[model samples]
Target: MLLCFMGSIDRFRETVPLAELEREGRVQTSVDGRALALFHHEGEIRVVDNRCPHMGFPLSEGSVEDGVLTCHWHHARFELSCGDTFDPWADDVQTFPVEIRDGSVYVDPHPEPDEPPAEHWMRRLEDGLEQNLRLVVAKSAIGLADAGVSSDAVVERGVRFGSRYRESGWGPGLTILAAMRNVLPDLADDDRKRALYQGLVHVAGDCADAPPRFDQEPFDTEDVSFERLKAWFRENIKVRDADGAERVLRTAIANGADDAHLAEMLVAAATDHRYLNTGHTLDFVNKACEVLDHVGWDHGDAVLPSLIEGMATATRAEERSSWRQPVDLAAMVSETFADLDSLVESGAGTEWSPPASFTETLLSDDPEIVVAALEDAIREGASVEALAREVAFAAGTRVAQFATVNEFSDWNTVHHTFTYANAVHQLARRTGARELYRGVFDAAINVYLDRFLNTPPAPLPRPASSTETDLSVHLDELLDSFDVEGEVDEAGRRAAHYLDCGGDVSLLRERLAESLLREDAGFHTYQALEAGFTQAELRDSPEEVRTLLVAVARYLSAHFPTRREREQTFTIAARLHRGEKIHEEGQ
Candidate 1:
């Protein structure tokens, strides 16, 4: 097929036979060296350049079915309505209009005029919005799935397959379904309304089809998908577009949507992800505080404490040098609360305190405080897991910075001490607190010595050795130095002697205890003694502890009689300084 530009509609009408061409199913034509395919269906005639947009395939040879002309070579379909290719990979085809008048059908060898019908324009807008809704729902569904919700669960929650109007104007149809509880009072209780709101929030940006780019952050220009669009919307929500902002706001308000709510939701979503960047988070916090002060939630007295607590949580997390920081959730929450407070302060209305216990418990730093707060928040309709995680994170940060075993032990004195203890243990492992950990392990072993007496402590794994030192001999020498025959608890006395000899007796004594308690105690006992002697020598004179530790670790591993015990011995020895308990039973 070809593009036959017959000058103008009038000139073309006079030249071509309008009636005879319509009677024929197809017509072959040419223009500009390109072949063309012309066909009539239901009184409407379409003329398209015959080449497939994806590849140079003949359209005349293709089949016309269901208002689509399909290429025979690649099955690329072009819609006769728009002359646009249906294949996602294909480009649009060139279409020309045909008019039938008198006895002739005239093919206007020119591009169709840009005169879109009113209905077509409306359909275009509606279709774009519908496509956006589908994209939102699909993205939200994936996010919910990731968050451990099944597809069946989402459906059960009343998220039917339909679109809903969101204040933000960018959410899925599911959001509209959720809002129906509010729109239709007799549908469900206020409790359902709240649930729906939360569900809508959960899925709001869950299925963003594109990734977002924050201010000043570089974005990949090529992958501008739905996610990117939402991101751009979020980043630019507060920015006033001189030409359209007023019109957009006026239109939304006229449609019964709250303009302020839309703006706030946009800000909330944008700020949520970027809140950790100090500059951005602080800005939101300050704005939230201002809102609170204006509304009465700031109550003067409540503001500082809230800000301090929130900032403290942020600062602690920051100080720990963690790769991923908390989302400054506390700050976000504080700002939100402050906003509510402002409403009351202005006498617009008294905002319901989000359950006094709820606020107190969530803002607390203590695990017990958090637990209590979580329980209260859960009862008061807050996300229990989310609040619990927030508290856990704050407590974890403090535990990571603990310098002494006493601090860790003290922190565990409260109820629900396991969480704190676990945190302490994790921090101990991370910090390479081998010596301090040895002390803790020794203390534990001492408490359970009788129970472990019959069972041999598992062997320590051997480490890769860089030196050829005979660690066994060195241990034997250290053991020989101990006056096991003395009246004193010889083990303790020996440990003191090792200490005096400049050994890291703290770790050595723990290792010795572990070795004695386990079945493969012989080799580990020997290595522990050797390590102790080496440590002693290094401390008392001009030797390096790294050399000794590395050498002893390797030697014990090499000489181990059993491969099973070898790795055990080396690992235990390597982590001797780390606070992991030496398991008496083998895995």
Candidate 2:
């Protein structure tokens, strides 16, 4: 039986008769256009949103047992009294304050005064982390930001959970955070939150259900020699003994090892092994240092050890046939190491036209010859910086030049070489350590290793002369032709034309950004865009920037033929956020 509506001006409307709720155990009703379920338990009535948070199922059809309501669809359960969910993916439903007056039940239909949004969302973030709830994680990140929590706080929360939960050390989740963080300042305000959510999704997803590894207490040493500690650190790191490595590092820091020396130690150890962990180990090491930089160095003792653990456990990329075979690239890499000092000394610094020259050697398909040419160029006074710049361009070219392959995953195969080379370029630039030349050599060899992936190479457009037609007008037409091979060939040609007509390098950056922003992009595409911007900043001459941008144009044209699928995901999330129902109860 239904009761006549009555309240303080209809604020708390009578929902259902107490006897009907008690007998039926639960009842469904609508209050001010909102679906709600009323349940009778232990002589008390509880009311909550009737639509399941997971898929918006009608909770009226759900069963109430043992103080929990289980939605039939997907079996998501919520507490009858509090509306808290048993599953993170389902999310907690909203509960309304309930009242009883003379055989009648009433609901306020408005949330009671409670915790602030920031605190609530922060708690939700913790729950999301605990249950590895990706959607919840994203929603909480956005919520926290909207509630005025600092990005640093949000980042610290994730880092704390990631470092604690993933005992084996920094993995792809943390790496994704590190990488995307670089692009954060450049993204639009809304995109910054999206990037943060993207990073948190990975971080939480990574540590979900992972066994926690306890960190060992730092060694209490007062008088350890810096050299000996460094030596011990390298040895332990080599053996993948994280505890021992941490003790050594802690001891060295205790003995007044500044950031520069510590950085040198990391760089030394990173480059000590050839392209350690197929170059990712070194990249992780760099990123870990960067993380320490992001969060105060005070947290170094806690965070840096994870990187050591990651390096010690990582598989050597050189061991793979893809990196080892045909060119005997590893041996060539070793040979370059033997004469690195001489090569650096030999460079008298010359303006060798980049990227064009670098591309020629990469296409030669001979790792030894490429190394020999690099040494010769350095010996002939080609600045190491110049070589580094050209190397980055060549790396981008590898991506831009990639022809269609049967394996879809090959995109990453090619991307790894580019990223590795870019990493080497960045690290070498940062430390200016002479030994990093070996890293440059490793990058070259990997480039050689990827030679076959670019079968049926796309032709690069030539540099344009003054008075060439404005290329911006054809942007859409060129992009439209991107999906079909050889159809978007004009993209490269237009890039050349733009560069030839004395176009500002900023325009290159703008065009690349425009092309990417026009469609949804995956991680690789985002990374590629970052690499292009990084190259533009690192290079001096217009020619270098032009080569990098042209490569970007070619790569985007080839790789991004259609809008990415993430667009639809964001769209659905928006609709649901606005309180719109997405799917029918059962259909």
Candidate 3:
């Protein structure tokens, strides 16, 4: 043993005597709570952090041979002097400066400083995205969150990366990113990071299989007016010319069309064909606007262009016989369009609420009746958003009441309709464009198309059904129900009871996120949960919230307990973050 003192980067403190270290070939010691490993390889004494960067295994127990130190636990090898890991999964270990003076060894706890925390994490994020390493991305998310980096900054990186990388344009990954961003305020601190992590991880994965995006340049002249450009853009979308639409869109942005105008243009084209792409086109357009809100309209060049491909190529509902036949819901929606401007003008200056049975008529079996009721509401002073909101509320009941007897994929039928209606509701609130109101009509018709999903409507979780007063108990019951397959009705009952007992909405939201994130949830699941929170917030009644909550619960429960490979990967990331000894045996 030797008395030791440590100094800054320029100096080193004495550790064990060189003679004893030479005899043993290696030694471990603690200084300032850090486990330091001293290795006598060749003629020099080298020092490094004893803990493995991957899982906090004791590297002192690892083997050093020929200037390479390998952790036996996972066989991660690092350079003896610089501590660079040969394995990317195992991050570089911290190596300290070593000196020898007067037959004793000295070590400096600090090494040359690297980049700033935020910059380092951002760089790590880039690497993670590029490599599609889920664990690496998870660590980057955790690091960024710990460094107090706002999700806005993190999301900007993801959007730019995804846009530049995925040739297929905006996919579920970017939607998840934006949707998760929308719900962050409702999540707990840890769940917030998880949400960001899930978004980032999905982005990396979504881009992995696709080739890089090659954006086309703006048109040669910036002489196009907004109206002319909008016309050309919609025309291009109608013809399914993605390249032409991209060029026109790029022209619009270059000619100074801001996000609001850009969104209106998208909504107009999206509604032109009535529920395009089974509602994904509209839903995706809505998400694009959302992501742009936080990442900035300045990024419209990168973020907005990605949506052109989805828009121009989306499948129009008119192509489906189900929408065209048995009711011609498509034409019904189109007929209402002619009167939209006048109806919207008539409703001006009047705050509107749904007629008591308006949504019921929208949900009833008759498509004509549904269309007539919507038009009637507009005449009776129902605003575009008020109409869209009730339509979305009725759409929620489809999910809350969606029958288990239907084939499992039918959950998505009602799920798609609700999300589409909610997207319209979201857009309606953003701007009062008369053309955008077409989506309200399109979405209502979609809900009408999905009426059979409620054939044997699942019992609504009656609010007062549960007498349990403890919110935590209700939350626990909700989670436990998810552990079983098809506990859909039970899950809804639990959430309904939680609200009945006056559970905090935010806390309930956090619990929902926890449940969803705990499994291998899908893209639509994220959308439903986030959209449910937003839609529920607009309504003043507990009953409305219950309906939304039950809808989300059943939707989530129906898809619960996926292999959870994603959660397993996330758990590994969390353990590494906590410096837990993951490689230890006999726990």
Model 2 scores worst on lDDT over the 10 consecutive residues at 565-574
Ten residues in sequence with the least summed lDDT for candidate 3: 1-10
Instruction: Quote each prediction's TM-score.
Output: 0.23, 0.77, 0.95
lDDT tens digits, residues 193-246, model 2?
666776777788789879876867656877777667777777887777777877
Q: Could you tell me how far off, in angstroms, the CA of residue 99 lies in candidate 1 after the best superposition?
A: 6.9
Task: Report the C-alpha displacement of residue 7, candidate 3, in angstroms.
Answer: 11
Once fitted onto the true fold, the runs of candidate 3 whose alpha carbons sit more than 4 angstroms away are 1-11, 345-351, 465-468
- Give each prediction's root-mean-square deviation over alpha carbons: 26.6, 5.7, 2.4
What is the overall TM-score of model 1 with all chains considered together?
0.23
The candidate, 1 or 2, that scores higher on lDDT is 2
Q: List candidate 1 stretches off by more than 4 Å.
A: 1-9, 13-29, 32-35, 39-46, 51-58, 65-68, 73-106, 111-587
What is candidate 3's lDDT per residue for 532-587, written digit by digit as tens? 98899898988888899889988999999688887777787778777666766764
- Give candidate 2 regions above 4 Å deviation: 1-36, 40-42, 100-106, 109-113, 186-190, 225-227, 239-242, 253-260, 314-369, 376-387, 405-410, 452-456, 461-529, 536-573, 585-587
Model 1, 452-545: lDDT tens digits are 2112311222222325344444345334433222211222333333433455434553343222222232322232323223233323322223
